[model samples]
Target: MSKDQTRRRILEAAGPVFAEKGYDAATVREICSRAGVNLAAVNYYFGSKEQLYVETLQYGRDPEGQHDQPLTWPADAAPEDKLRLFIEGLVRQMLGERAPWHRQLMLREILQPTGACRQLVERHFRARMDQLLGILDEILPPEVPLSRRQQIAFSIVGQALYYRVASEIVKFLVDEDQRQAHFGVDQLAAHILDFSLAALGLHPGLAVPRPEVTHEPLEP
Candidate 1:
């Protein structure tokens, strides 16, 4: 295989092993073995186990991440629509190509964050949050504390992630496979917009209150 092809094989192989075994437990030898590449090939491509882990995730995230720099939405679009596009784009990135092990890998990373995870949070996620908060400023009063603006942003974000990250437990709680599957990111995105409107001290009759910020930011 060509060098790029070889690298692709290694990253593809590494994702599941890292997820099944975790970052510390999973070794380069094991990932190489699974990829049918010699040990040296990994060092040749990624230079280290940590970088290889990043390559594995970048495979899925790069498309979005590459284009995911802060956006200035159209002058015509409403703040609500701007918020919706940002969220929909985010959900697509998280659920990229149904790369499921990413969710497990993410849970592992979040529970016990590595240096790389910290960088990702600082670079990718925090950047998004800052941008989202700026847009949210129009609807939310300026006097609202940064904590509460974040709280509002998190509510919108969490609604988008619940199905992908916590659906197994959520499915069991609901006890309906059909309903569980239907509880998709699209529906989550739609629901969150309504939730966001209510959170800015306005009452939307019959809107369910968000319980609390319990789960960490789901993959996106």
Candidate 2:
């Protein structure tokens, strides 16, 4: 395999192993064996198992880069409109049908953070939070305390997470067809938008809905 292909193979293999066994129990040998590469390949591509784990977190964040950046809104878009788009995108990123390891590895890190957590936070999570915080600024009054703004930001984010993190429980509670139609990206996005608006004391009934914008590819 080419170097890039070899590196990708390693990451793809590592994601599931680390997610399943976690950082401490997962071994370099198992990852290499799964990737179909030599033992040295891990060191060659990622330096160490710990570094490999961190890069795998990046891959899980968006190997496809579907959710790498915050949603783009037109300059003249309403704050409510902007917030809706952001929530939809966030929900889709979290719950959209994609690789299992994408969420599995992330949840592992969250529940049992390792050396990789800090880098993942610095590289991915913080930037996404800043984007949400920017959206909150437009709708929120200036007098809102910074601490309160952060709480609000996390509240919005937490809603998106609930669908993914607790997805099994959700599936158990709803019929399969009900789960399919209601939990779809577009529907969930609208629900979160209306729910969040109501929580913020904005009238969801008064907000105008616009066509959801198609996502542009992540920046290279």
Candidate 3:
């Protein structure tokens, strides 16, 4: 294989290995064996196993290095539209539209951070978090504190992640028919958007109306 092809192959192979075993447990020999490349190729191309792990993460997150696509929107787009897009992108990523290993590796990092974890956050997640916070700033009232805004941002992301983190539980809780109907990317995104907007007092019409309760005295 050509140099670029060889490197790409290693990265592709490394992503799943590192994702499954994490940085410490994963080995270069296994990665090279999986890639069908010589063991020396990893050291030559990525310099070290740690560096290879970092690059594998980058490849898994965005193989093309297309950083601008997800957060990009028309300048004149409404905050609500931006928020919808953000939630959709997040839900899609969590649902493995990007790739299953991408989410799996990220979840592993969050749960058990390593030396490369900071780099992952700084390179990939910080920009996304900033974008989400900016959207929340537009939607939430000015009086809302930054701390509270941060909480709201985490809440929004948590709702999307719940479907992925508890996928089996979700399957057990939601029948296949209901899952097929309402748990799709678009449906879940729309639900989260409407739910968030209503909570922020921005889209009261989208909120589900609560059933009226009657209080009647019972005769003895």
Candidate 4:
């Protein structure tokens, strides 16, 4: 196999292994075996097992080769639209071309988090929290604690993605129709968008409603 193919094979193999075994418990030998590649190839492509593991769990951009289209975040797009894109992009990236393993691998990392897990939290994920802090500040009153935004961010991401990660429990809790409907990413995104709109204290989707001007009646 070509060098690029070998590297990708290793990534795909190592993700599940890390997911299943946790980071420290996982071994390079198992990943190499899963990829059906030579030991030297892993070293050549990634330098070390630790490095390979980190790359596997990072907020990876999907490997689209030349055909990967960039998200067109129009200047006028609502913040909620951008948020949905971020959430959906994350979901798609994990699923890659293999949707079935997406939950298995993701749930493993979430439930049994490893030290390398912080690499993601420190990088894109933490930064995402910061952005939400800024967004929520715009909607909530100035008197609200600075910590509230960060907490809200955690709840939003945790609520939406964890539902997908822990789908078996969700399936058990909900009726068949709601479960089937939310199984698709667009439908999932819609549910999340509605929650986010409420969190932001606004109407949702293609239109953001005008605020009603309510005046209190004068004392009679």
lDDT of 2 by residue, 1-220 (tens): 6879999999999988987788899999999999999999999888988889878888877787677444688978988888988898788778766647756676566656675567765556677778888888899999999999999998898888898778889989999998887778888888888788988988644355535646658679
lDDT of 4 by residue, 1-220 (tens): 7768888898888877776677778888888999999877778888887778667755232344342243446656677666777667655544334644434544555666656656554554455566556556656678888677677777777766676566678778888996666556666666666777776667644354535636658669
Query: Candidates sorted by lDDT, descending order?
Result: 3, 2, 1, 4
Cα lDDT tens digits, model 3, 1-220, are 6789999999999988987788889999999999999999999999999888888877877889665355589868999999989998888887855566876787777767776758765666677889999988777779999999989999899998898778999999999999897889888888888888877778765535535525557658
Better of 1 and 2 by TM-score: 2
Model 2 TM-score, all chains together? 0.75
Q: Which residue runs does candidate 3 get wrong by more than 4 Å?
A: 1-5, 24-29, 40-48, 59-68, 97-104, 205-220
TM-score of each: 0.70, 0.75, 0.79, 0.61
Give me candidate 3's TM-score against the actual structure: 0.79
Q: By summed lDDT, which 10 consecutive residues of candidate 3 come out lowest?
A: 207-216
Task: Looking at model 2, report the run of 10 residues with the lowest lDDT sum.
Answer: 204-213
The most accurate candidate by lDDT is 3
Regarding TM-score, does 1 or 3 come out ahead?
Answer: 3
Judge candidate 4 at residue 134 and give its lDDT. Answer: 56
